[model samples]
Target: MDPSGLPDFHGLPDSPVPSGAHDSPSLSALDRRIAGCRACPRLVDWREEVARTKRAAFADWTYWGRPVPGFGPPDARLLIIGLAPAAHGGNRTGRMFTGDRSGDVLYEALYDVGLASQPTSTHSGDGLELHGVRITSPVHCAPPANKPTPAERDTCRPWLIQELRLLRPTVRAALVLGAFGWQAALPAFAEAGWTVPRPRPAFAHGTRVTLPATDGGDDLHLFGCFHVSQRNTFTGKLTPAMLREVLRTAAEAAGAPTRK
Candidate 1:
């Protein structure tokens, strides 16, 4: 562990499999490997720089300073894919969708739909839980200006692909937030053994696509929803009710039980 008490990942390979982590076939191992990645030089510098020069609001906190891993169970039936971690949100808390307005909107909707145990995700050990869902992103590192370059996105694709391959056995549905996530997830799905359509589906709010599994498993139902960014939520683009409805539909498609 480093001075921050987190695992030390200095000099680790950017990709996990190439570093001999493939031998450990478990989500936990994959997560550790992901946390140790230093693949994109730009992302590495930005995330660490933010960690060192802490935000005023989070000045007392010890930033994660590493790639954020997917949250929820390994056997989750539903997967929610977002673009990437927020600079001060996941990058600080070390958990996806935590400590930000976007997370507030997301977890609230998940709680309303019976997928999340709590409506607030303040920290990693806040007892938050997802019943049958896993939340992840194509780019695990927090990028500058809330955007990653296309090359950086490609460099991060392997991690998502590996994650999909691990989750393929049980993941029955995916809800992608935003066009970036939709674009990133489709190719990863195809690489992970799903049969994407000849002409890839376009992304739009409430768009749904069904992908057949090549391994003869259950079909993967893909859904799209507007990202829970403040810009979208505050502008009346993606309201609470709208987000909840998409969550409910995706949860049901995954055969995941929901109270509402």
Candidate 2:
């Protein structure tokens, strides 16, 4: 164990076989790559600065200070898409929806709807598990002002596309957390050659849309909802029940079995 008593995987002895000899590419590996990425130098520098100076209120906390990566079961069919990482939230936790007020209500609703194993999201090592759901974002790296430009969003779409293609989920339903996520994903599908419907509607608390698959076969269903950010939850704009109902409807539309 390391000084913190956490398992020291980084200090393991070399194995007989090569590192990639018997391993298969997985979401965990993808996450690691994203964590080390410096694709956007501005974001890289800004995130690191926040990590170094703005420590959490809790003394024991250590900022993740890396690009937050997608997290959940590998074969999860439902996808929860958010706008971008928050400076003090995912940017500090190295995992989506951790270490922020936004996560408190989100995880609580997920736990209530059987998507997560725990309700409180304090840190990455909190033993939380997701069932049949994966949380991702339009932009993996946190922007300086929490708003990525259209070009930046475009630049990041390929990564998300790669993730979706690798997972090959049978029923893909996006829980778009805000207008930005919806805007980013729509053009992505179109560029993939999917003929999307016109007049993309504004995001609301619970709105759903269906689109033709960009692959020229199958269909992709998309759901829109207000982001469970501190702004929304703290202002009573999005209640836990409202979020839960949106998730339930999305799950049903995707044809996934309801949690017991």
TM-score, one value per model: 0.93, 0.84
Instruction: Indicate which candidate wins on lDDT.
Output: 1
For model 1, residues 14-114, the per-residue Cα lDDT tens digits are 55322323433877777878887888889999999999998887777889978998999999999999999998899988889888999999999999889
lDDT of 1 at 26: 79
Root-mean-square deviation of Cα positions for candidate 2 versus the true structure, in angstroms: 5.4
lDDT of candidate 2 over 1-260, digit per residue (tens): 21112211353332221121122266666555555556666777888888778654633556666667788888877888888888888877777877677888888888888788988876677788887788998788889888887776776776676566555545467688988888887765565444568786667767777777766665767888989877888888888888999988887766654564
Q: Report the error of model 1 at residue 53, Å.
A: 0.6
Q: How badly does each model clash, as a count of residue pairs? A: 0, 0
Best by TM-score: 1
Local distance difference test scores for all models: 0.88, 0.72
Candidate 2 wrongly placed segments (more than 4 Å): 1-25, 56-59, 191-194, 214-217
